[model samples]
Target: MSALPYPPPPELGWYDEDATVMPQQTAETQPAANAQPVASAGTTTAANPPTTAEIAQTTAQPTTASQDDDDIDWEGTVLSTAFTASAPKQEYELYNEQTGQRIIVDTGVLLGRKPSQDLPQGVKAVKLDDPTRTISRNHAAISFDKDGLLWIEDYDSLNGTYIIRDNTETKVEHERMRLQAPCTIRIGDQFFTFEQR
Candidate 1:
């Protein structure tokens, strides 16, 4: 099997191949004759003044899809846990491999963030064996397992747990499920998605 908790790199977009051409420069666009070329570690000449395209390329924000195989963005670092009996506020703390930084997330207020969606009617996620449970009690303790596996245990709910893969859904009617990276889990009506960092 392929590596768990990781999505394959996106296919190259059309712009990639077309944008590799060398940009042009002209004397009219060059700096005034009186300006001194900044000196660096070595001798310099005006034969190759940087172009706007070059500067834009140097200073441009790197696209997430352009990342190397080993690089990861915030979306790739998603981690989550689900609950059945108790509904504690959901929380997430993720690392950005590209930036080497940490990010904190609170699920309760997460709706204010981007990528919002409305819950579907009559579709709810719940803990297994908890009849009194409502769609609200989905709580989980999320941490990366030693093997890099994600362990999501049902705290005990009525309707049980459901996991979604490739748009196909599977119900969890047991104590817990060992989640791999880049999987989606649903508790009651709420949905949570995670990916590798």
Candidate 2:
């Protein structure tokens, strides 16, 4: 029998009539005509994304003040005024036992070695200058809460803060404790008495 003839080899050229040519698809290339483009990570799709005109319109709109007169709640204001009026009208006085100096704390008081210039609007600074330098520059603070209750907080003092009540001394740090009248507060070697006036 005669040997079978081999098929012809494929044409190798830029333009081959019988060869099937396919375009390469790459990340940098545009998508096919009928293929839907994909959105990258964290990117919004064109189907529901905001248009440039909409974004510009939103940005061009003028902003009004958040607190308008019509938005005020008169009932809430009346209730707040009533609560404040019912609260006690008591004041506290801090007297240094050793130095014989007094500070009348109407709102709040900050006790330290040197006077603090950046104290809050209603807070007073009382200087406790010691010859031994045991007290910190910002040692302690005394404030009255909304309910007219006194509170004492130690401002991370080196020697610590002590509250002496009824012959007992309790060290306080980091947290504000309820301070009663006729109690002594000891910061380093200086002692101050909190009395109600």
Candidate 3:
């Protein structure tokens, strides 16, 4: 399971691979410079930036997908897989227990502040409203796999990601964790419950 690669965070946006940055500078503070400051990825140089050819190969769009549904007005995140008539089709409803908000999810979802807006072809992301500022820009992801299973993946967020069920709270570890409906998902202070539709 290869996760998509997004630009580091807004705090780190000032540092691009081409615009060199001095080693003494940190993410929080930057001084005015006449020349564009480039960020060095260890030995990376402005002459040779990393290419997205590798990323595109890994996160390519699926050959077959359904975009006819407009009831939810949001297309599910379609993972790269072979779609077949025998594939199981299951939809889940993500409800905000606190706000009574309902979100119907079938394909996959990238949850954070504002994801994919910057990426030209990145997977469309669902914006998570977090005035508390605990969630990262690309905080977590929910993907329905080809095998008809749901998985939750954490993006190494600052605070953390977790799943709670049966009165026991379990953290979403580094790897993607399998998720069952009728459970609560916590990204930072926000909480949402999922049930099969």
Candidate 4:
């Protein structure tokens, strides 16, 4: 008795020579082994690669401009612009209530005297040259925080800093204070108004 079932299955052989399983090759099906395989219409094959003419023909197909425009994300562009515009700009105007002078605050902070090599960058130092000698070289500083709140700090000046609201005066010494617009900021004898446009 055989140990294997079903005559141990038919012996495997090369497919080309397996006539009982594979159909005989016809002239249409078989080409010379060295010959490149032919490509069908509108198809590409490794051996029969596309010609320049065929490539040009495919690329020459006309495309509508409107169809190209439809691919753009206009809504996203508009939303991004609106988000950028909605962000609070770091811009303020400082009006000298005493002299009717105005200065734009665009930098991070502003000092009373002209900037020197010893001072750090991003601090806009201005020369006030106060004849009263009440203002210090760096009397006070004005800046805006990330939340767009305006802040004023006294640099421990000799005379002192004051914020007057509704005809009342509040002293601000070494500490910082949140500045509200349309109010008076008295740095020594000189008074200024902080405003946002």
The candidate scoring highest on lDDT is 2
Candidate 3, number of clashes:
6
On residues 1-197, what C-alpha lDDT tens digit does candidate 2 reach at each position?
99999988655543433235555768668667788768775455779696788678778976544334324554345556556564467777878867887888878888888857797787888887676688999998888877878888999999888999989999988699888889888888888887888
List per-prediction Cα lDDT, in the order shown. 0.48, 0.79, 0.74, 0.72
Best by TM-score: 2
Alpha carbon deviation, residue 196, candidate 1 (Å): 2.2
Query: Candidate 2, after superposition: displacement of residue 186 in Å?
Result: 0.4
- Worst lDDT window (10 residues) for model 4? 11-20
Residues 1-197 of candidate 4: C-alpha lDDT, one tens digit per residue: 87665555455453324545766789888888898767778989986789999899999987756546645655345554445643367677778866767878766564564423355675667665465778877777877665667788888888888999999999987589888887888877888786666
After TM-score superposition, what is the CA distance of residue 193 in candidate 3 from its true location, in Å? 0.9
RMSD of each: 22.2, 21.7, 25.9, 16.9
Clashing residue pairs, backbone N/CA/C < 3 A, model 2: none
- TM-score for each candidate, following the candidate numbering: 0.31, 0.56, 0.53, 0.51
Total clashes in model 1, counting residue pairs 3 or more apart in sequence or in different chains: 15
Stretches of model 2 off by over 4 angstroms after superposition: 1-87
Q: 1-197 in candidate 1: lDDT tens per residue?
A: 98678876665454555456555658877788899877674334587777787677667857555655335555576565432233433444433343333433332211111212343442223222223243334443343333334455554555445778888887765665765656666655445555544
Per-residue CA lDDT of model 3 for 1-197, tens digit only, reads: 89889876655335443235545767556656665657654433567665687457546855422224432345565645675333477888877766566777776788886765663342357887776788888998888766878899998888788999998999997799999988988888888888998
Rank list by lDDT = 2, 3, 4, 1
- Give the TM-score (vs. native) of candidate 4: 0.51
Better of 3 and 4 by TM-score: 3
Model 4: how far residue 47 lies from native, Å = 22
